[model samples]
Target: MNAFEINGGKPLRGEIIPQGAKNEALQVISAVLLTEEQVIISNVPDIKDVNKLIELLGDLGVRVEHLKKDTYSFQAKDIDLDFFMSEQFKAKGGSLRGSIMIVGPLLARFGKASIPKPGGDKIGRRRLDTHFLGFEKLGAKFNYNSKTNFFNVDASHLKGAYILLDEASVTGTANVIMAAVLAKGITTIYNAACEPYIQQLCKMLNRMGAKISGIGSNLLNIEGVEKLGGTEHRLLPDMIEIGSFIGLAAMTGSEITIKDVHYNELGIIPDIFKRMGIRLKLRGDDIYIPSQPHYEIDTFIDGSILTVADAPWPGFTPDLLSIVLVVATQAKGNVMIHQKMFESRLFFVDKLIDMGAQIILCDPHRATVMGLDKQVQLRGIEMTSPDIRAGVSLLIAALSASGRSIIHNIEQIERGYQDIDIRLRALGADIKRINTMPKQH
Candidate 1:
């Protein structure tokens, strides 16, 4: 196991660049299965989940070549449909929630797809109903064996049709788009997710000759192309990582700049973070957060506490709520954080509560965080990272605390944040990464 020992109360000072978006890369990489031509993708973060997906793709007969440390070329010219391998994939599917995206493309192109229950954050039951429903509209049938937790999909010659997804799920939207890109006719998807990450996928597909219209809108029209050709694409910087860095700088009372942020892609990130009373000058696409001694949450004109909630595209992202929640802890006011998308996402609030912050857990999906408002400084304690976002949240909490803190299960953090300890350490963060075993207690 891996863990981070952080010496708290140290202010981070330095400039940092965010890594590529893990969520985007996951879905984009899976889309490679739709073609038999070589696709060169750059700006790929070398994280655990991406590495795992690459390994999984390689094991499934895709040839993945590393052009550079953070760039790769993939060609799924040949794929072996072994039932055992498909079952193994399903068993690990939830590990990277994005892996489910391959189901639609695989069924459409290869006639069948089997992936065991994919693993990811245990925040809630993220249903694949919308994904399967969209796939069904394109001529796919699904069956599941509860005993083995196996999911299998089969379809022959996906037919283009209108698909209205139940919810604008990011993954579900990508799944249908991937499948419909090569359907027998034109496909229309309404209520489609238009996140920048999804837009990137749509653009990449367009580059490879897919007739996709409405690049950045909720309604997408894709005319089926017989095949997709090889293309080169670069991933946008990870907005989640950018948000995490903003939280890190604010909590540590540090001055730091984030480079190459792709601000155009960050539709509402700047405004969302502003709700916590932070406003930074944008130097081109870079953002520089200055150190503030006393950060305050922006209050309403009527003097009532404000709430920060996440929603579908054009709104704040649900993934960054954990980071925002941690930032609210140090801010000088009360703000309620409503994480409407996931059930267990607020489980990390208990850790903040342990650190002398006041947070009322309304339920599995919401928390009313009464900010310390820079009055009560949190004391350091040992922490275990439960998930990717939570791990980073704990790290932020630890760095802003009064003493030393040890964070275990750091691999969860590594699954998303690339060279996290090294990067933070460069910014004056006193963090050490080490392998851990049971201590004689």
Candidate 2:
């Protein structure tokens, strides 16, 4: 296993650029399968999950060309549908959660697709009912084999229909949109996820000849096109990474600048950090976080304790709650973190507690953190990374803590953050990657 050894208490400096959106890349790259013509995508992050999806595409006979660094051209002119039945496909496709996305485009264009139970961070029970229900609404036949944990979908003729999602799931919306774009008639998706990534997907699909309206709202209308043409797309900067950097800067008391952040699309992230009293500035498109000796959390106007909860787009994102929780550890006041979407996300607070931060894990979904206000510095200890967000949260805590710390299962962090050690190194972070040897029996 690979681990990160971090020497803490040193503040990071210099400018850092956020990586291309991993979530957006997954959606847009999967959309390439909708067209037989070449589709070029830029700003694709060189991370494990995205690379695994690209490899799966190549394995399915999609002509993939690495045009340049972070740019690729894909043409699914001769997709080998037969490969879906191969053991190779089973092994590769089942390994990535994003691999489930390829199913929509494959079903839309070629009339059928199958994927084994997709794998990803063990945060919670992420149900696939939304995707399948949306597909079935678009006239697709769905089947799940409990014996093999495989899902198969097929639609000889997809006819668009109105769909009110049980929840505004981003990936589910993307999948349904991809399927409905090629169906006959109009598809109205109500209570849809309208995050910037979803809007980007809809905009890219429109450029590829899809008729989609309501770009940035919960309601979307898509009119089916016979076939889509190729289009080039550039992914937005990863807002999650940007948020992480903001937390990193605040936790370490580092005056750092994050470049090319696409400010307007950040939603409530900046405001949320500001609520924590982390002083930041918006210069052009960059976020400049000044070194803070002490930051305080803001209570509600009624003097109640501050509560930060995750909601859909236009609301605080659940992904950044971990960072917020970590940043709150050193702030001047107390705040409650309500992770409504995922129950197990707040469990990582135990690691933070071990590091000498004052945190109360109230339950599976709630944690109340009392900031030490820099009066007490967190002393590091060995820990295992539980998930992607939690891993980076621990990394940020380690960077700001007093002693040396070792974090195992860094692969979770690498799955999302690109060249994290190298990037933090550019900003003068005392962190390095090390391979741990297997235990000898």
TM-score of every model versus the real structure: 0.96, 0.99
- Residue 393 of model 2 has an lDDT of 99
- Candidate of highest lDDT: 2
C-alpha positional error of residue 145 in candidate 2 after TM-score superposition, expressed in Å: 0.3
Stretches of candidate 2 exceeding 4 Å from the true structure: 437-441
lDDT of each: 0.87, 0.94
- lDDT against true structure, model 1: 0.87
Steric clashes per prediction: 12, 0
Query: Candidate 1, residues 1-441: lDDT per residue as tens digits?
Result: 777888889787888989989989988999898899999999999998888888888878899999998899999998878833554665556466667877876876787788777787666788989899999999888898898877878887789999988999998999999999989898999999999989999999999889999989999999998988889989999999999998888888889999999988888888878879776779987999988887779877898988888999899998889999999988888888998988888998887898898999998877888788778899887777778998899999999999888888787788889998999889988889778752332
Task: Tell me the alpha-carbon RMSD of every candidate.
Answer: 1.7, 1.4
At residue 273, what lDDT does model 1 achieve? 82
lDDT of 2 at 332: 96
lDDT of 2 by residue, 1-441 (tens): 899999999988999999999999999999999999999999999999999999999999999999998999999999999999888988888889999898889888999999999999989989899999999999999899998878988898999899999999999999999999999999999999999999999999999999999889999999999999999999999999999999999999999999999999999999999999999999999999998889999999999999999999999999999999999999999999999999889999988999999999999999999999989999988888889999999999999999899999999999999999999999999899888752332
